[model samples]
Target: MQSIAIVLMGIVGMLIGWFVYSKFIANHIFKLDENFETPAHELNDGKDFVPTNKVVLWGHHFTSVAGAAPIVGPAIAVYWGWVPAVLWVVFGTILFAGVHDMGALWASARHKGKSMGALSESVIGKRSRALFMIVVFLVLLMVNAVFGVVIANSFVSQPDAVFPAWTAIAVALIIGQLIKRNFKLIPLCFIGILVLYASVFAGSYIPVALPETLFGLADTANWIIILFIYAAIASLLPVWMLLQPRDFINGMQLLVGLLLLYGAVFFSLPDITAPAFNSQTATETPSIIPLLFVTIACGAVSGFHGIVSSGTSSKQLNKETDARFVGYLGAVGEGSLALITIIAVSGVTLAASPEEWHAVYSHLGAGSVDAFIKGGANLIANGWGLPVEFASTILAVMVVLFAGTTMDSGVRLQRYIIQEWGDIYNLNVLKKGAVATLVAVGSCLLLAFGAGGSSGSGGMIIWPLFGSTNQILASLTLLVISVMLIKLKRPAIYTLVPMVFVLVMAFFAGVIKLKEYWLADNYLLVFLDAVVLIVSVLVMLEAAAVIKRFRRGD
Candidate 1:
């Protein structure tokens, strides 16, 4: 029955969005403070502020903001069909990405941890934190050049998911040397999830490949310059060796690839054959009111999950009421992985046929990662008979371990915003951290070989300016967390009503994608969508002049 009513209405809208984020946004609007002092126990310094483990920092903040941009923006916004992309991924993850990721991990754990570009000038001021760290360094250089062309287009279109996504980087560098000697966490997370499912059954009998051109530039742009030279030496290590045990074995391989695609669609039900409101595929795609709010930014609302909720889950928050279970259950686990990628691309285009779902949605380009890995490998081969190239190599090793833990935490949040702009200008080689991880993986290898267009398709030439600069960085991180809830009076009308609907639908979807990249002239996505609509209209008129000078008292 319509594929068991799209997995029982997306698990009853993620259990009514974690019961309205634990009853009305965490006990009536962002209360949080369970004995406040946080920055991982007052800067624990075991490197990058330690104190984690709220379910391993909610599986490293939901696999570092669940990558593959919520399965390529709701599999190209299911051409505005699947019920307006599942009611904007279930009421935009219960009222705009769970209150802009629990008001950016409760305004960066109440400031000390600081990051939504250093609390956008400590709550809207000081030159608006250098224009909010140059719009968070052009949205982490278009999230490290579109997840370095989405893990080099899932390793040149799934060469058997490059040996179980490089065997979870040698089993997260041997569980970061058994968590640097102390090892014990439930048998090192059950032997690192049994060595990530025996490297996905030894990558189904060894399947790695490359060299179809190397220096002349092809083998998927030399596997995205060897995945940004292993994300510039794993972004200068020491997150307990290899980004916290390779994001705790890629967050148990993203909860064992979303429990085998929602337990094979609730035990093989598979029905909904696409159209739930196609309107002629939203009149040939693009424009489902501000390009479906900038093409379903991260399953619904993501100004880059408030930079992984204040750049790295509020610096590994341990308490202060674990910021509503790690920023509203890590945005309800990426709005239940964008509601299981809109019921696995509308029930795998109802088991494809309309000339293979019009050559994978005729309008929205780059056959949306081959129509979301052939409609989630024909809904896990109708729930059991596996082998659509082994269920598209287990959905291309869960899209290269969720875009390699989002380009390994977008190159450690672009090496802590290029070592905080080299301590605000002195520039002693961007204050070290291996020269800001070699200038953040050398500006993501010069924007992944200069915005790769062909074969490389540098993340599909900026996937619609990474969904309108990720919903204009979620409408300037909900106007800098509604000007830090009007400097703590605490009732900034719940982040000023989704920050005026994501600042007027991400500045009218970056002025209709800057007149469709200036009539296809495509001056680099018409100068990066007119510099993301002029630095999002000067960070929304500097957060409406700091909410009209904090209501006149300024």
Candidate 2:
């Protein structure tokens, strides 16, 4: 079948999700009230809480939650076949991700923009809150550290992307100031795009490369340190100063990139080179049942989205009703990216034939972000007549910028978690923004350098556990939302159904990884995996007890 068919299917599915399902959810299930003052107004401190336009907030939420996972996960999961990967992205987005993301945002906005972990205390119990926060902190650490490495590696490998990558920051700073002065958004958006693409064009001509070693560390390691430092500073800044504008611009860039990719599909009309289901499998490949769900977390449903929804987005929501737009549509935007990634890697753009595609995906974790870049560039070059080098540079910069935004939000969220901890225990030290920022960055740095030595690749060591761990967190977030719905005396079957399915699959995936870690003698992953399982089970038990008590009127 033609790859356009797959594209059409995904587009139609997501449209239905947005226009029909999301409206029903907003009106009935979530019951978002436009008059309800959000935390951004209720707790407006001009630092963390500032009322934001829905469109701008959507951009921040979308780009922050996207990162590289949607690309990387679906890119790799095509090993199972394009059918499973595409279906998961489309249906998962409509049924799972939309509700999860939107619900988290609504829940948080209702609770004064508290993070999901902190909000758990009100809905579930105090014990559940601490357990929930632990999972959240671990997830943030993994995200920030790994994304620092991801951006650093992208800079080194694709030097052309480096100039445009950093140029974006300057554009965002200017845009932020202008927006604060009540500048018109449409014009600023156009100018930002023009400047950004001009940088991309210029970058292709004047590539920037760093030395092999800097400050007695390898270039990648040095880049990692620099990235974390930048993230720390970015996180410390007010949302309007950097995070909001930067992410908004990056989100616009991604929209243009997606249009180019989808245009390539229409013009070139490439054939699906991958099989719907793989009869021939690698010996090392895990079963497709649960693994596929965990693998394609972001494009479908992700726990990380909950973090961003509750962490930063909720704090800036202009109106409670905007949750559907900022959260659910933000999820649809990611699903679109993931869909294009699947086509880029699975269609003739990547491999000329099914056999060639199979060879490229010979192993379980064979295809990745590199494959997406190469394939997407080729597709654009073929269809749009752009030079392959220029196309590659655009896509590379897209990946780097996305990952960088995610790192920014991850560090900020981590600091929030730390501050919440201080409030929970009356520890004044952790309550200070600067001190919390230090602890956040310090933990990620220690994990990177201490675990990976001078190479600073330790984040990847724990990355193998991220897929299962992330999905499990998604389940837990859904669980928290479901509990909130029940407590409010509303229909919770929407959240409850998705929560049950995700938890079962994620739990199974964790068990599978635990056995693999034990056999490989990767005790660190084994211990971490076991801890996640235990905490998840305990949280579930706590929720069950609360429900039981509620039913008993106790």
Candidate 3:
């Protein structure tokens, strides 16, 4: 029954995404003027604005947006029956997330690839643009902070993951440099990924381990420093050698992950191990509503999509017509990837055995980071030919890589935002891109430091912020998208409907949390909760105001 419903949901999601949301993106919202050609085709800069094939672009787009959100969200959300959560995944993708992403692409494309900040100013108001930047800045701060902690936890908890990932990255860097310096060495990159995965399996069997001697220096702090160092180098390096090549090599990790997840589901067919409903789960839930929305945010919606849409993607658009297929359809496809992750994780855990499921959740620290690994260990021991520990280790390596790839992307975007902020605000103190890079790196470091604690366990402080901030950003994005939809003179209600829902759910959640914090004995969470709630509401109200004014034709 669950499988049938999920399959049905996927079909419905795909259909609505293709037909309903995509049409508006391609035809109405992003409709380019007949006189102007897209920069991708007209400018033809090989470095940034070069036109590429759709498939390649899709690959780039998918990797850029795909990360831990989809998998983590559904895994956690399954606490609310697969019915409610899956409904959100399917319906949100079709109506809310699909519209938000596609609309962001179209709006940005029409404006000649200006950023989300610039678009907010030109379309809405200058004040709103500044607010948007401030809001997004904070959101990125939370993102870097959370991901830093997540990676650290994965490594610290599962010591086996650290070597494989480090080795994989080192191998990838060498292969990338070879490919760039000697273009004929392309095949070696693929070979490196294979060798790296094989090494992970071998390490699992042999158990080459690291010392737990960093008693004072938390794992999160270590990750922050490591990520900063890597970012510093990555920022300074040529894209061809590091970023692009590594993405291509690391890209297979996602593919392998999907294949393994799918195989486990079909072969093992593990019963779901979580509860469908429980009040206790809500109180003890790691997810606050604002936080849950933020955490689960990518599959449903995100403002970051707007940044990508207008920044690089708009410039790379080959045809105005392709925006629908590329932008709208592309978002739907991205959502589908998230859906796949959710389905994969959810299938292994269910609503029946909350305690047992909690055990599985705790085992995330036990050399395996996902339900697939935990569930698969049992299944593989029962069904598959491979050893359970070996299979589990393979899954861990893939997850680490998946989380690590996003770190690079996050740094890159953070740098861009810092540079733009410096220019717009006229902060000469920030110097050129070099200083901006440092500032971005420094900011991420501070965020990492703030959450530094018992590696993964103590990092929970900032983890809640991701979902709250992410949802808040999504609301702001919906405002811009709604305004654009109105400007294009489509039925604004379509965009407005989902936009309103996200805002209401997030706002109410934020307010309730704020009250709880205020009434609590702990002033720290009270203060934090108050700030999170207030900022979130202000952003939502600001967006609503902009959309309202745009609608009134004022």
Best by TM-score: 2
What does candidate 3 score on TM?
A: 0.82
RMSD for each of the candidates: 22.1, 0.7, 4.4
User: Of the pair 1 and 2, which is ahead by lDDT?
Assistant: 2
lDDT string for model 1 (343-431, tens) is 87776433454446555666764346566777777777777667777777777787778778878888888888888888878798898
Error of 1 at 174 (Å): 2.7
TM-score of each: 0.35, 0.99, 0.82
Better of 2 and 3 by TM-score: 2
Candidate 2 to truth, TM:
0.99
lDDT of 3 by residue, 2-65 (tens): 5435555676867877886567555654554535577676767555465644443444455555
Highest lDDT against the true fold, candidate? 2
Please give, for residues 376-456, the per-residue lDDT of candidate 2 as tens digits.
999999999999999999999999999999999999999999999999999999999999999999999999999999999
Error of 1 at 217 (Å): 51
Candidate 2 clashes: the total is 0
Task: List the pairs of residues colliding in candidate 3.
Answer: 272-349, 272-350, 273-349, 273-350, 274-350, 274-351, 275-351, 291-468, 294-467, 295-467
Instruction: Write down the worst ten-residue block by lDDT for model 3.
Output: 360-369
- What candidate 2 gets wrong by more than 4 Å, as runs, is none
